[model samples]
Target: MFLIFDNFIFDLDGTIINSSKEVFQCFAMAFESVNYDIDKTRLNPDIIGPPLKEIIKLIAPELNDENKINLICQNFRQIYDNDENDCSELYDGILEFLKKLKKHNKKVFMATFKPMIPTIRLVNKFKLNDLFDDIYGIDKFGKHITKEEMIEDIISKYNLNREKTVMIGDAPTDVIAAKNTGIFGIGTLWGYGSDKTELKKNSNLCINNIKELDSNCEFERILK
Candidate 1:
C-alpha cells in the first residue's frame, strides 16, 4: 500500500525545536565576545530559522563587507559552539513524531539555513542523526542554499521521486524552496514563522499542530 506522503523534509530550529533560549544565549555571547552588547528582545533575536545573510544584513546593516560578516559569524559560532547543546532542546512530541514517521517507513531529513556543522552536531547530540537519510544545511560561507539542492541531494542520495517528497517547515523560505524543487510544501503554525505571510501564502497546505500534519491535508495542485 502507498502512503499519503513518502518523504518528509523537516526544517530544524523553530519547526522541531523550541531553540530560542539557546539561540538568544548564543547571540548574546557572540555579541559580548565582540564587545558589542545586544538587547535580545529589542533586536528580535529569535531568528534561528531564517536565512543567515538576511538576518545578518538586518542586524548589522553597517557592516556590509564580507569579512565583517564572517567575523561576526565566527564569533557567534565560537560562542554558540562552546556549549551549543546548552540551550537547544527538541520541541514537545518531536521525538515521538520522528518515530511515527519512521514507523510508517517514510524518509525524513533536515533542510535548514543553519550551517552544516552545528546542525549535524545538534542532530547527533540529540540522537536524531540516525532518523534521516539525507540531512542538509548551509555552508560555512553563509550563502542562502536553496531547498532544491537539498531535495536534489536527497533524491540522488535515496533515488527518490520528486512527487513523493514534501517539505515541512515554518518559514517562507522552506515553502519557496519546496516549490522551486517541484515538490509540495507544508508549513506549521506552531513555529516562529507562524501564519505564513509569504511562506504559507503559496503553500499547498499548513497545520497549526504538528500532529495534524499526516494524511488528512487537502491536496492543492498535486499531479499524478
Candidate 2:
C-alpha cells in the first residue's frame, strides 16, 4: 500500500496522535478561566480535529472579542505545553509504519490545522523529525488557514507529484482538500471524525484500522 505513493501528507491531531484528553483539558481550563461555562462531555469526540481557537470560539462564543479569545487560547497553550508528553500517546504500529515508509524511500509530511508552536513541539518531543520530510501548521496568531491551502503549500514548496501523493486523515475535510487539489485522500477510522459515512463518501479509500495499511485488498482498491 505504501509503495504506491511516493509522498504522504498526514493530519496531526486525530490521524497521528490521540491528543483528545490533553486537548479537552486545555479547552476546559481555558474556558473556565474566561468565565465561560461548558460541559466536559461536550468536549471530546466532536472537538478533537478543528483548530484550537476555532473550537474555543464555537464552544464558548461568549468570549466574543478577539482579545478574550486570545486570552483563553494563550492559557490553553500554557496548560498543554506544561504536560504534552504525559497527555498524548501515539497509536499502536504508528512508529513502525513510519519507519517502514522511510525505509521504502517514501517522502512523508504533516499538514494540520493545529498551531505551529505545539505542532513542532510535539514532533520534536516524539523524535519524529527524521521520519517526516516537512511539517506544516497554522501561524502562531491562529490565523485562518484551510486544509487545501496547507496541501497546496506543500505541493508548491516541494513540487510534489499530485498523482503519486495522498492526503491521509481522519476527517472529511481531508478528502475534500485532496479532491479539490486533484490528488488522493485516504480516511482512517481511528481518528475523531464522527461521520465515517461522509469520510468514505469523499475519500479515495477509507480504512477501518491502521493495520489495513498493510492489507492487500485495501491497497488494491487504491490502485484500481
Candidate 3:
C-alpha cells in the first residue's frame, strides 16, 4: 500500500538536516560565554528538538532568570549563525525525496522549533527555498508559537485538508503536534532527537531510513 498525502509538513533540525554537532557545540559555548556551566551530558542530541528557551531550562535548571536565559539564547545565535563552516547536511536521500515530492505536485512546508533567522539561513544555504511552499519557525515574524500552533496556522492559512496532510519529523513532539492538529504523523528513526521506542509508540507510522519515503517505495497505510 502506498500511503499518500497531498500536504507534507517537515521538522528541520533532526529531520531535514543533521545539525547535532553544530547545535551541541554552540550550546556549550553559549553557556560558557554567559559564565554558566552546563552539564555536558545535557547538551546531547536528545535536546535538539525543543525551542531554545526550553532546552536552556532543561540543561541549566538552576537558572531561573528570564533575562539570563534570553542572553544565553542570543549568544548562541551569534556563535551559531556566524560560523563560516556549514556543519549541517541534509540527511542522505532527503534532497531526492523532497524533489520527488515537488515533482509530484505535493505541497511541502517546514515547521521547526528553531527561531526564524537561523531557519531561513539554513534553507537559503542549502538552496532549499524552492522545495517548500513555506517555512515556519517558533518565532516567525516575532510571534512565538508552539509547533502545534504552527501546524494549525499552516493548515488554516493554506486551507489544507486535514485528512490529506501529514507531518514528518524525528521527535515525539512532532508526532504530538500533528495528532493535536488532526493530521497523520510519520516518524523518522534515523534522526537524533527521538528515542526509538517513544517515537514508534506515538507516531502513526515509523520508518528507519529516509529512502523508505522515496516515491516508488511501498508505504504502510497510516491508520486513523
In candidate 2, residue 127 scores what lDDT? 87
Top model number, lDDT: 3
Sorted on lDDT, highest at the top, how do the candidates line up?
3, 2, 1
Estimate, for each residue in 1-224, the C-alpha lDDT of model 3 and write its tens digit: 47768899999988999998888888888999989877898878877787788889888889998998999989999998777786888899899888978877788999998888888889988999999999999888688888899899999999999988999999988998888999999998988754578888889998877767764332344323
Stronger candidate by TM-score (2 vs 3): 3
Give the runs in model 2 whose Cα sits over 4 Å from its true position. Answer: 1-3, 61-66, 140-143, 216-224
Which residue pairs in model 2 clash with each other? none
- TM-score-based ranking, best first? 3, 2, 1
lDDT of each: 0.72, 0.80, 0.86
Residues 74-177, candidate 1: write the lDDT tens digits.
Answer: 88777766674476778777798888777667788888878787787788788997788777887633565576787777778888778888888888778888
Model 1: CA > 4 A from native: 1-3, 43-46, 64-67, 140-144, 215-224
Candidate 1: C-alpha lDDT: 0.72
In candidate 3, how many Å is residue 83 off?
2.5
lDDT for each residue of candidate 2 in 43-138, tens digit (9 for 90 to 100): 867767777776876676565688888888888888776764547878877788888778777789998888787888888888899999988887
| Candidate closer to the true structure by lDDT (higher is better), 2 or 3 | 3
lDDT of 3 at 64: 94
lDDT of 3: 0.86
Of candidates 2 and 1, the better by lDDT: 2
Among the numbered candidates, top TM-score falls to 3
